[model samples]
Target: MTLQTVRSDILAGTVVFLVALPLSLGIAQACGLPPFVGLLTGVVGGIVVTIFSPSRFAVSGPAAGLVTVVAGAMESLGSFSLLLSALVLAGALQLLAGFLRAGRWICLVPGSVIQGMMAAIGLLLILQQTPVALDTDGDSVTKIISPDSVLVALGALLILALWQTRFIKRSRFLGRIPGALMAVLWGSLMVLTNDYLVPGSLADLDRLSLPEIDSFSEVAAQFSHPEFSAFWRNGAVWLTAVTLALVASLETLLSQEALQKLCPQQPQPSADKELLAQGVGNMLSGCLGGLPITAVIVRSSVNVNAGARSKFSVLLHGLLLFCCGLFFETLLNTIPLASLAAILMYTGYRLAHPELFLRQWRLGAVQFIPFIVTASAIVLTGMLTGLALGMLSQLLCSTCASHRSAIQLSSYSNHFVIRFNQNLTFLHNARLRDLLAKIPDNSVVIAEYESAEYMDRDIWLTLAAFSEAAAARGIMLERWPRAEDPQLVDGGVH
Candidate 1:
């Protein structure tokens, strides 16, 4: 709020704005929206949302991961405007989620699943952007890759290597310059110079255009307005809207966690508040014929890297977008698609590093298998379905392990004892069911846990339920807490 603070924010925002510009456009294009909408969200997200957001240093804008979903919705609705309406609905849901303090639910997602998601997204990025980086053009996703892309990818790899080299790493001046940004600049210049020396050597850069605000109706017409009658008639629309809201919320929560790691001094944003902020931003952007917005990790990292001390950095970045749109629109069009593609490819690599998976594998197969399965599902199918399958697999694996470690039960005509050797979970609840079913009415039951290391909530709840049922049966239940208890009766119980 102060002048000094304002000055620092301006500097930080400038850096982030530079980083966000290409990304916003590329993501918007990928989502099948006019690139301008991406810019609009980036500007609005920074300028407007940051004012009320809890995380002062985190930046928000169009996210690359949401591109496919947005595109599919637009295609399904047969109108971009209707998708906007869905975005508004999605935003409203997010706000409600925030108010309900449901953001904490993100923590319930297993860490392995999250790692798998990031890795999959990274792989997707490399696949999608590599072609663009090489200036390849084809109508379909498969056609995007060419020999040229392979060369360009190599160039990008070299740039990354140089950026990580000790000389650049140790130099304060050099380290401050983001290697991704530098690569884009160098690549753009190389393309431009190549064009001058040998015409048509590089792909024609005639596709870029400056967005103009001719009339409000023109912008409004771009989006396909939701038909209330149609929406009610079809359940699919509602399902899609719910899916968007849930996925967007999860991504935002993850981005917030990542942002906190990047800038620890800043207070963490309340999940609910963060949700509301993103919802409002998306709602407004969609209303104006823009794409959906979310807490993007790349821009947030850029803000932190740029020395942003507060949310004002976001505001400043938005201001820059507004000014560019208002005054220097033409200059913005000069940026080549290839340069933007390079930026995305770099971002993708960071997201889907192979080494992350290697590290997870080292932890244990229980952790690594789920992570790989989740990643594969996401790539082969879609995000939500893959995640569901992964979670199910994790549950099954856990249950099997628990079943294998279960203790045997022995019983007499009047008394019975059941023992467990390992921790218990919901997966192991069935064992209790079988044991209790066999116990005779009015029998004495000894529930032993001497070998148990831990018990999850589900197991505890099941036991509590069994205790109630046993009481009804006129059965006395005694729990042996420790292995050293006097009533060993070791015979076969050990």
Candidate 2:
């Protein structure tokens, strides 16, 4: 990359690092780990992966979607260290998948499913962070936010509104800053003012701290080693690990693809190389007592928005994290939890905003219904499950709607008119068969198929059969010349 590109990348990277910092920690906390582990993963993903990755703009780190899996793994393994072993195994699996060229299969996931996944994640973030935004102590996902949280959410919402208004858009100072970041800064000020105005009204804000990883032995003691002897005995653990790997990889591949589309200067990464980078990142992260890491869309979006032009942005982000960890720990810790909540709530709103659904609805119900169902399923259930169901529903709807071909057929007493609008395939054979059955023997039937652009083997076979039947019935079969079919109009035949 050129110096200008490098400088731009660094600027973008800084923006992404700031946005990712709190999110990584929050995800770690949500997954029942020390917040520092999340920071460690973010650093490693930014620094180490950037060196080996092919994608110029994609940012990798701990993802919120895998929080449920990590939390469950910790509970099952009975220690964070044991969970690390599984992560190592998970990394191995991803590497193996890359080598096997399985990354291409991710493209098979339907667009509806991917859209649903995004919408679900957005909703999950909203639900999880709403409590934190309100300064509530609620930890349960199902818990309702108190009135205080409602007010705080509204205040953050107002900040987002002001940031989006034309006044801020035209302002030199505010226009250059990200609206979401501004919302966080304003929300932090609001929290401090509330604390000062009414003492003890807001809960005591927790201080940030450097993750404590003093010794290798301490890391070793966090969890039991992976039980190879009981590998078959504890099938559940293996299954969970494999599931986690798949989900993480899917998210990574999708994020990389989306980033390439969003960032004009950044080309898409080689899927296999990305897999290896993530595998190495996860292995190191797990060893460092951190949560599993993957490419996150939110941070990638921030990087793109901040004018990132190359992979250096990821490296710069890692350097920032390392510097914060080594020297600016105290300053980082001073950031209030509510401020982070405000940032996340704003992110969530952008992801699943009502306008997106409304826009999808305008496209057609075929697309909109699946989008709504996917979003709802994610809101009601978890991400992966919701995606699976939404994809199935989309496939069913598509298949049911595609039962018959679009070619229209009409028949008169003496002549039969078969007007083909587009391509004909096996799907159209049934309709063609029904139309052919109504033709009378010894009648003059003009089999018109001029509008047909292409015909598959099955349709060709059907036509040949119909030609034979029409010949026996003394009916004339007339067809226009198709570039691929030179037999058309041969001596007033086919």
Candidate 3:
């Protein structure tokens, strides 16, 4: 690479690393795991996943989307070790899926369901973090209201809120800095200021907890391992593994597709290869006791916005996370939990924003109902169950729409026209039969097939039966193309 490109990648890598650090820690906390495990996952995503992935701008790490799944798995499985074993199996499933070329099937999932799933996760984050932000340790209002924690959380939230405004974004230096890191700094600054001006005032505030590590060896010593025995003994482990593999792969592919839009000049990455890379990363992350990983849009967007030139930038970010864990453990622990909670709350708000709901509403009920159902189900049930419920709702909505619009019947004085506006399948057989029965005996009829792009065997059989009855009833059925198409002449019935 040229010096200029190398410089750009280096700068981008640093910016991504800055963005990834706090998110990793906060997401780990949300998953009920230690903060360092998030970093460990980030390290694996950056270094190991990047090695196998072809996309230059896509960045993978512990994601907010997986918080519900992870937390739920932890609660149900009762141990992080078992969760890690599930992740390993999930990774294996993803690897096999990639080899089977199942990535292409991701398109079969409707956009509404995906949006609902994300919105649900967003809502979950907001709900889960409220207690942490308020320092509400299941106490009364007065006891829960800690001045230091509340102020820091609000201040960090304010910074994040303002960070996206054109005024702040227009400033070159400020724009280069990530708001999450700045929020953490704001929280840290509050603690430092309190200590310097009025010590012990911030003592009661909830702060990040992490063991101090002075060296790489010391950091490695804290690593946890997966319990492989859980794979065979626990049914829940397999179910969780399937859920993780499906959700993680879907999110990764979607993020990659979005990143591709941002970097239009970049060649499209192989979806199957991306899946394989994520599988390897998750397997390694599981072995090392880290949170599950996926291609994260936030960091990937930052990498693109910061002018990442190659995958080297991704690799560099992993090294930075590893170095940070060793050298900056004390610095990280100084960040108040309230600040991280605020950051997560902000992230969640973005996902479940009013505008998203409004947009879905504007898309009509076909999209809106499924979106609402999925989000509600996720909030009420769980991730996998929510997804299943959302898909069912979507299918029902689509089927109703198709049934209503699939066939058009018009008649003028016994001259009838039957127009197929959509592809016909077995699902439409009954409706087709009913429509044909309505035709008056000895009526002249026209069957238009040009509008339909396809007609399966069931539809063809239905039409054949109608044609047989048409002749017996003294109805002359003319096979014709659509009236709008002037290129074809009508042919008599079969």
**Best-performing candidate as measured by lDDT:** 3
**Evaluated with TM-score, which candidate comes out highest?**
3
lDDT by residue (tens digit), candidate 2, 396-445: 76764554445555667776677666667677788877877877887665
Per-candidate TM-score against the hidden true structure: 0.76, 0.75, 0.87
Q: Candidate 2: where is the Cα deviation over 4 Å?
A: 1-6, 68-86, 134-152, 187-232, 264-268, 369-373, 376-381, 410-416, 419-494
Stronger candidate by TM-score (1 vs 2): 1
Which prediction has more favorable lDDT, 2 or 3?
Answer: 3
Estimate candidate 1's alpha-carbon lDDT, on a 0 to 1 scale: 0.72
lDDT of 2 at 338: 59
Q: Which 10 consecutive positions of candidate 3 have the poorest summed lDDT?
A: 485-494
- Each prediction's whole-model lDDT (CA): 0.72, 0.70, 0.89
Those runs of model 3 whose alpha carbons end farther than 4 Å from true positions after fitting are 138-143, 215-217, 410-417, 422-494
Superposition TM-score, candidate 2 onto the true structure: 0.75
TM-score between model 3 and native: 0.87
How do the residues 1-494 of candidate 1 rate in per-residue lDDT, one tens digit apiece?
A: 68887777787788888777767877876665666777787887887678767887778888877765675677777766567667777888888888888999998888888888777877777776655665565456665454444554466557866987899978988876777666555555656676789877656542346656566665555443444445655555665577678878888889889877767753456888889888888777766667777787877887877767777788888888767655665555555666566666666777777789789899887788889998999888877787888787777766665586585678877889888877666667777677768778898888777676566555666666777787788988887343333443441223
